[model samples]
Target: MASLNKHSIGGNIFLLLLAAIFMLMGVYFQWLYTNESNAALAEEIAYQKAQEEYHDSNIYYEPEASIRWLLLRQHPAGYFVPNPDLLFEPTQLNDNTLRATRYAISILYELGALDSINPKTIIEYVMENYLADIQSAGEVDGAVYHNGPYAGFGTLSSRPAAVRPTMDALLILNLLGGLDDPRLDLDRVNKFILAHMNDDGGFWDEHYAQSGRNSSLRCTSFALRALSIIQGHQKKGFSTSDRERITSFVVSTHDPASGGYADFPGREATDSYFVFRAFISIWSLASGDLAERREYVENHMEVDHTIDYLFGQHYLKDEGAFSRYYRDLQSVSSLKATNLIIWFMTSMGRMEVLPEKAILQYMMSKQNRPGEFGGDMYTTYSALSTFSRLAVSTEPMSQPKKPTRHASIPAYFPLMLFSLSLLTLITSYFTKKHEMEARNHILARQASIDGLTGILNRNGFEEGLEKQIGQAIRHDKPLALIMMDVDNFKDINDRHGHIVGDKILKEITRLMTENIRVYDIFARWGGEEFMILVTEAGQDKAVQFAEKLRKIIESGFFGIESKVTCSFGVAMYRKSETIDEFVHRADEAMYNAKHSGRNQVSTVPTSAKKDDRVVEFKP
Candidate 1:
């Protein structure tokens, strides 16, 4: 009987071995069928050299369609517009990863790619996969969830109290764009933040870090930015006095001498990013003090010296660092830093209401492969968002154009493709690759523009608008200009504080978006200032539209405690008017309304008298 049992066990083991071999064979065959066969070392070498030979220029995206095509194909889950290689990689999980996922989804939605995925599904996925993990770590005040494995699995004592993740979580909740699903827990997030806010009005990561410890601009900026979003989104919950206190704290944190804001009220590591965040937070709320601080950073804060300082820290590799101040420049991973920088530049653009074109071009030039740039998500987002925001800036760069059969090959690479019958089959593979790439480019461009405001930003506005503007002039179409300014904007900022002021502006942006037709263009031109372009609209029509916009703005669906109003200026195209000239005329008209009693429209012709320049209404 024992012999029989041993023989049976041996037979079973033999069967198991056979099954394992078959499974291995199946996996190999399936991989071979669906994907490219694994390249042998020799083949890989030859292919890489061929790719290099094929790409004459070092610029990855340009001149070589095949390479660009190959890189883009790797983007899984066609969602958030994938950044390029050299940026940062997304981790599978973290302690507060749910919040990061929320922010990522918002970015994708903001970019327009979120349409492909169900918002509910994505939200649920985050809640299940990431949020549950966060909740398991430790709860904060039973309401705010803190002490997570998101950053890392360190005890609370060992970790730096980071306000960025929490703030970001709040902003993500705001960006969910109004489905009051209880899963978001916005009130809980706010309460969490408020509980963390030190007596000094700045927020710290934990209760221990809340007192006497130095606060960082990185943390402070994220906290303020997040709080500003909260203020805009959840207006009723935060009291008027609390809003005032927050605003006052934001103002006080500004470094008077350097104009570069510190991370917290007292610490002084004035960085471009923190300064930018400070300015943007202020700009979003229209806090003149914050705007003034931005100007100080721009005009007074030495860029060259700061660059030198950063360079001195050995942080200026192909990829950049998250922060640098002291001689001992401690570094964070590149992904976080990259986004912070990109966001900083975007904020600066908002403050100046102009494009940082040259800087942006340099950043774009640094984009590497497959939606990554300069070694992390932070820098990649920074560069992309900055580019998106500054699309209309008067910076000179090469315009994007569709490739044609007649298009000349880049002068460097001749005889790169030997047009043979067998090669044609190989070339067909490349052609399909190129087509996929072209589709992605289109999708990515479309996703990045904001839908409501016909202006290019946060998605679709940046790429297309420039092409359209260039095409319009090439085709000689009349372009009408309108500049609209929110009246008593400062009053709103002061009364309700910056958060409600932001909501008011966002609502006004929505209104302007609704009023403009398909042929027209509108952008959040500056803080509480909007610019509109009407194609082929005559002076009479422009004036009429301006009046209508003014009336519409005055009607105020913003629904704050008090009524809001706007003043507008209209300018029709002139025979030889520059973009700047057109904008200036509209600006002058807007100023006229400001000087004239507020909430009125003024249409200025190209040729207006000096006295007419400052048109005054009856008191």
Candidate 2:
């Protein structure tokens, strides 16, 4: 009887333990499934939120606020002062007076403020006080120019003709339809500008006699823009060849590695002003090749990268203003950087991406609210221009002003459940591990492939280029790099929605992959830009391949009414050049192809013909 009793107890305990184990296993599996589902849901929610923010359409811009800020800077003297509070005092004015006045007038005209303001009085004041006859001064053959403002009266003899002031005055006059003014002699102004053109195809600041300095980018930009405006009023302008030479000079100022323009040759440091001026100069000269000029700017300007750098290094995000340099928030707000950003956004047609409210608030903060000018003349001018641009932007707005939230549970609620289930089953460990591994694999794959086209991304392309460059250098084998961009891709995107545009890119990628050799490494460089690395190929082979690709693209059906075309640039790897320089040469060639005409191949010449670079191949 005692033996029976002991056995019964042992069996009961064993049964209980078995039951407990089974219950725990069930709990573990349930927790694992729930955790995985919750994680996926969280990821999806985050992605949706980000997408909503990125494409938010409820943003609104008030132009009146900006216009009010600009109007506060105006003085009763028919000119804009750096500080309106100083209007009652004897304020010293210089070239900026002319520039500010022009900017203010231009913005007012653009915003329909001219209806309220009497522009005739201002125009007359500027014409009578600023315009000077160069022939009378015996400074040049013919031309009337702005003498720039003087500190005291009867100091006209002391004031010299500067390219910037003259350009500003001329642009203002042109804007006001005052080109036909009896006091303004267009023929004389044209001759004066022509005489200032240096042998190097740039212009001097002050007729080369007053300043006696080398041709500067700033002066050249102003002079070229003025001449371009003059040409619009009259039929005559700089000859095409002369304009081409001027374009070459502007191109030479570009730093390929940085995608920024230097102030002059041998000066590699880039400033926003210099880059802006260089772009304007090229644009003015390349009037006939407008598309090519835009392409050139797009390829060389690196606007997006530069903006990132400026924002990272100099922009005070919290304050919503840019500083002059990195980490110098206390310094006066950098109107130059701020204005550059605005211009860049406008030119790139990316106004929708700007932080409109923040920028507006920052500008308002900089201005004297009640009775004073907010900043210097240029600062006010830049602020006015930036505001005007923001006010006139045509970007669509979202219907609803606020984003809708879909999730009710906290993101961490799954964690609490996970803790409770952790003590349950052994199989749950393996399941979680497997899920993590799968997620990592997906991430790695995504990093290598572009989301839009399923091709190698920019990071992947750069990695491939580095590896190929190392191989080419080690073996001393000839390698060629090819750069190509879809001609007028922006136009396509504008005409068709982004969905169709994306489809076109995917189709183009498929076609490229099918046509290129298996050994050739190809990747999407950026939006509508693709690059190919061809091993064991000389310049001739590269050019031939580029031409072949161009033809294929031109003939391919892109699901649009118009035929798709691409411009290609080819360059053979040089013995001493770095990878960036090599790529830049190819880019330059591509730019030349676009400049020459779309659907063509251009090659950078090898060592023997380095002087005769950028040879174009047309089909």
Candidate 3:
């Protein structure tokens, strides 16, 4: 009886162990099923969001193409050129203008492309050329404008740092994480910026705009941006009266007919640039949440009218580009105008109303090559920026919280379109053949432009040369003509093809543009040769200038695989000499350079000398 009882207890213990094991297995399987369900649900939501983002309406975003074009125009020293036709020419580092670099660097920074560039080289260039004025934007130092004022930034550091360029440089430095840089003086920069602000409650660029106006929306926006960056993100700097005065000043620049702001008051022509500057100043002045900015703007202006003006007026749906002025043709469409308008729209929370597909098409049309947007860094910035902004999500964090912002759109659409159409008809009645005349004037000027290099063609050069000669005669200035021709250029074309030769000429033109004085005349004298009229400079100075150019070309940038050289010929313009005689002397001197080996500057002795001889300047 004791053995039977012990066996029963063992059997009971085994049954309890089996039951616990089965319960554990059930819980494990249930957890596995739940987790699988959750992961599948998450993946499905992600796919839906992606599909929404890449839908038909928002398909114009081509970041890859925009980046390709921008990179193509980038100089080695981190500057940028406006023309891509000069892409393959030999240009020096720090050779291109700061204008394009300012925009290009800003765009690249926005796109998070810092890893692609050497920031140190760029920083060094900026410090030396703009801020410190060591090199002076690829010019010959501060020989001119020696008494330049407020040296924060400018095209040529020799000139006074204007409000626009100064603010642009500061923005670039900020984008480049240059705050830690010791060379940047926030205190000095703020002082320069503050100096531009007038009692009119607007910023004035004494150097940039000589338009006689004391202040403009453009300068005000630039000043405010620089001031904000220098002072940090605090709103305590502007007083209640200051804000009110500013609000009143900016509002006064607005045009009710076009629903855009002008650069100045008194109903100036309202365009994309002015409107953009006005909007930025308005945003910068307003603090707190994005909703507060919208509220502030609404309190001041008929914000819906601005929206309608942008959509049905400035934005040409048919062209996919914006006009610089209202009632302009689609052919007059500008990348700058489109960019500024898009920037404004994106900021105002109205991307849904844009013609995204058309804009993409127009932007891509400007591309000269694969990944090349075929415009300057300004256009590249606009194109790339526009493309990126197109895909921006209108999520809760990305946009304003007000639902009424969307509601106002439907009410303003029909009225805006009708007003635009009516205005166009009225303008046609008043201005008889006015638009045609304006277009013809542009075409006439473009006629003289060299298609190869944006410089003057032979015909254009002749007209300009005659004008300069007259100016020299009037000012009683000594003048010299320096003619330059590529060495072995025909061989380069024969061996490397005409395409390579064309690039060489373009490079030469780029160098001339950088080295020559702004007032000096430069032109393409046809083929691989160019002409320069050195005003107020005698034979000695002109010869030296030619030599400088010879060296620059010798070591300048080469976009191609082959090395290139040039021969220079200079001649002092004899008083009352025929243009042909003057040109012949310079041409003969150039051949003398070719005969005396390549890459030398040869000058023709004056006719007054007993023996007319060719004197060559060599290293």
Which candidate tops lDDT? 3
Per-model tally of clashing residue pairs: 30, 5, 3
Greater lDDT among 1 and 2 belongs to 2
| lDDT per residue (tens digit) for residues 219-270 in model 2 | 7887888788889788665687897777777777766655556667666533
Q: Estimate TM-scores for all models.
A: 0.39, 0.51, 0.48
lDDT of 3 by residue, 1-619 (tens): 7877788777656544543444343334433554555666666676567566555344333445555667766666666666566755555233236666778787777576767777776776566545543234432234433443334776554555666777767777777777557777666566566666667787777555575438778778888877767666222466678777777788888887778788888774447677777787777778778889767767776666777776666776667888777644343688878988888777777665677778877886776654445345676677667767776422223221222211222333333333434343344334426756887998877878899999888888889889888888888889889999998786678788888778778888888899999988899898888999888897778888999999999887767666688899998877778999889889988887876777899985334255454567875
- Clash pairs, candidate 3, are 69-371, 90-557, 91-557
Q: Least lDDT summed over 10 consecutive residues: which range in candidate 3?
A: 399-408
Best by TM-score: 2
Q: What stretches of model 1 exceed 4 Å from their correct place?
A: 1-91, 96-103, 129-138, 141-163, 176-179, 207-220, 280-357, 392-619
Ranking by TM-score: 2, 3, 1
lDDT of all predictions, in order shown?
0.52, 0.68, 0.70
Worst 10 contiguous positions by lDDT, candidate 2: 148-157
The C-alpha stretches of model 2 lying farther than 4 A from their native spots are: 1-59, 92-95, 130-132, 138-158, 207-211, 292-335, 341-377, 380-619
lDDT of 1 by residue, 562-611 (tens): 77888888766555656567567878877777656668777643457554
